[model samples]
Target: MLQKADQVPAVVAEFIGLELDDAAMARVIEYCSRDYMSSHPHQFDDHVLRQKRESVWQLPPDGTASKAIRFSAKLSLSPALRARLDEVWADTVQKRLGFESYAAFRRSLPNSLGVTRVD
Candidate 1:
């Protein structure tokens, strides 16, 4: 996937008008790998067994190279984890904007929480 990203980085950057620095991009990729990929990684094997509970797949569009790998990325998080994600998102925005208060922050931008106050 990073290799695919390499093919279109400049074109993407041009459209977004945001300079894509290597370090920043790599950090974002690394963070995603830690959170998502670390839990469920692509697994492929031959002579498959019936007990491992792994998904077997054969993808199309294999004109040149063999797409011989696939996996079931099944993940479920509790409600507490979802709320934690909201907190993390708010923290990231607050740090980036240096907002005085959460209510002021919402007023300064678009409000999606639908709450009159954020205190």
Candidate 2:
């Protein structure tokens, strides 16, 4: 999807059998962009998930609450954990998604959209 971000609006429109005008298509594309979605995490129910986590954990609302979803350049993963994750991704996603490896999939995206390089 990230590979053809510009076509997403038209694809979605066709899937839903709706013919969106240029302006509406533009709006849909803008709203679906990574920048817009990351900026407006509430639209993805991040706030609700945070609230639920806080309630379950008895965390103070005014305290330093960790985000339910985060977009950042920082990544801290131990070598063992990273290896495990790679293995899991290979077993579950790589073949299904037609990627040789997670690294290859990450490289295929524009601007490394959701990826945080370890080094």
Candidate 3:
């Protein structure tokens, strides 16, 4: 990628949010692409996972540490479910396999929809 960085450096630099040269961009891509952790949608980062989990469900107690242990709490199965809900389920299952719990999954979801239930 470095050898051909001129082709997509801007997009990569923007996404990674670092002013990178071709060599740096190439290195970043290689680092992110080779690992299953980096390959995950949330990139398997703890802060993001915690935030997402909270968004999907209830917040952690006020005193909980930033690295609060993740746990899935029951959510009322709201009838106002969104389309392609199984995709959400699939994402959760995949996330739990190596990333986070159900609550964390909901928390990771975008916007207030994270707190909403599909099933």
Candidate 4:
């Protein structure tokens, strides 16, 4: 969540000695949101639903609120979406890091995938 990122930015700023303003906050949140959504569909939808159902809420840890009240957004894909995403992740790893093994691919997945990470 962006709230968790507030401390991250401050720490990063301290280390790098750079200040992050509202625009930087939004940019980082946006990037993280996309990655988070792509990685966790169940959690993303549940989070949006809970936010919509809340009549009032305490501010998130970072104190910056989401502009969108509800995340009714949907990512429509053909039935091959899962296979495609996996293939892409594998190819990306191969190209980027020279990983070329079934074990390496399996290791990259979340534990929910229930596959052994063996090389």
Candidate 5:
């Protein structure tokens, strides 16, 4: 979806069998964009998840509680963990996705930004 964000409005309109006007189509595209979605993470109800976690798990809210929405591009896995993920991806998703490896799949994406090393 991030790779072909410009086509999202058309795809959604087609799926819903609705003919959107120019203004509506533009609005849909904007609303579906990564930048818009990231800036408006509250729409995903992270607060509700935090509340549930607090009540059910008896966990105290931390600094990260207010920042639950995370983009994968900003995350980094340890080398061992990444290798394990690649192995899993190759076994499960590589054939279906037509990608040789997980790294190759990530490279194929447009503007991956950059991964932040947690180590």
Candidate 6:
């Protein structure tokens, strides 16, 4: 599974007006936050796994130690959903990833989006 921090840095960088780079990418992998205690309303007594910090849905298909894409069959995000994505997911990603600025990281996304922002 890909780190949520990995997904977040780029999005947050876009928020605060910054650009993503290799160094930022490295940081996302390096300084990801341990957990989201604040977001969870229910408490659990069971042991929490904090290895690479990924959702169960993101786990590798064959249980191998590799990143694999997870698919959502009913994926349909509206504008409000996208906005919420920016607020909830992106904010956490930027913070946990330890980037100096979220905006910069976001600026790097368009290049990968086939928009040709990089020149």
Candidate 1's residue-wise lDDT over 7-91, tens digit each? 3444545668977688876664553443344344333222234222233443332223212323446588899997886688678
Report every candidate's CA lDDT.
Answer: 0.50, 0.71, 0.51, 0.57, 0.70, 0.50
Query: Model 1, poorest ten-residue lDDT window?
Result: 61-70
Please give, for residues 1-119, the per-residue lDDT of candidate 4 as tens digits: 23354345445565688877888866765655645556655544455545654535653433323433334566677869967866886788778876665677666655532334444
Candidate 3 residue lDDT tens string, 1-119: 32333434455466678687768766665654424333553444456656777877888733233322244366755454633454676587755664334565656655421234442
Task: Name the runs in model 1 displaced over 4 angstroms.
Answer: 1-69, 94-119
* Residues 64-96, model 6: lDDT tens digits: 232222332556789998788778755787678
How well does candidate 3 match the true structure in TM-score terms?
0.24
Clashing pairs in 5: none
Q: What is the model-wide C-alpha lDDT for candidate 4?
A: 0.57
For each candidate, give its TM-score against the true structure: 0.24, 0.47, 0.24, 0.30, 0.50, 0.24
The numbered model that scores best in TM-score is 5
Model 6 gets an lDDT of 0.50
**Stretches of candidate 4 exceeding 4 Å from the true structure:** 1-3, 19-79, 98-119
- With candidate 1 superimposed using the best TM-score fit, by how many Å does residue 39's alpha carbon deviate from the native? 22
Which candidate's lDDT is highest?
2
After superposition, candidate 3 runs with Cα above 4 Å error: 1-9, 12-18, 34-80, 83-119
Residue 106 lDDT in candidate 4: 62
Query: What lDDT score goes with residue 91 in model 3?
Result: 84
Question: How many angstroms is residue 3 displaced in model 5 relative to the true structure, after the best TM-score fit?
Answer: 3.0
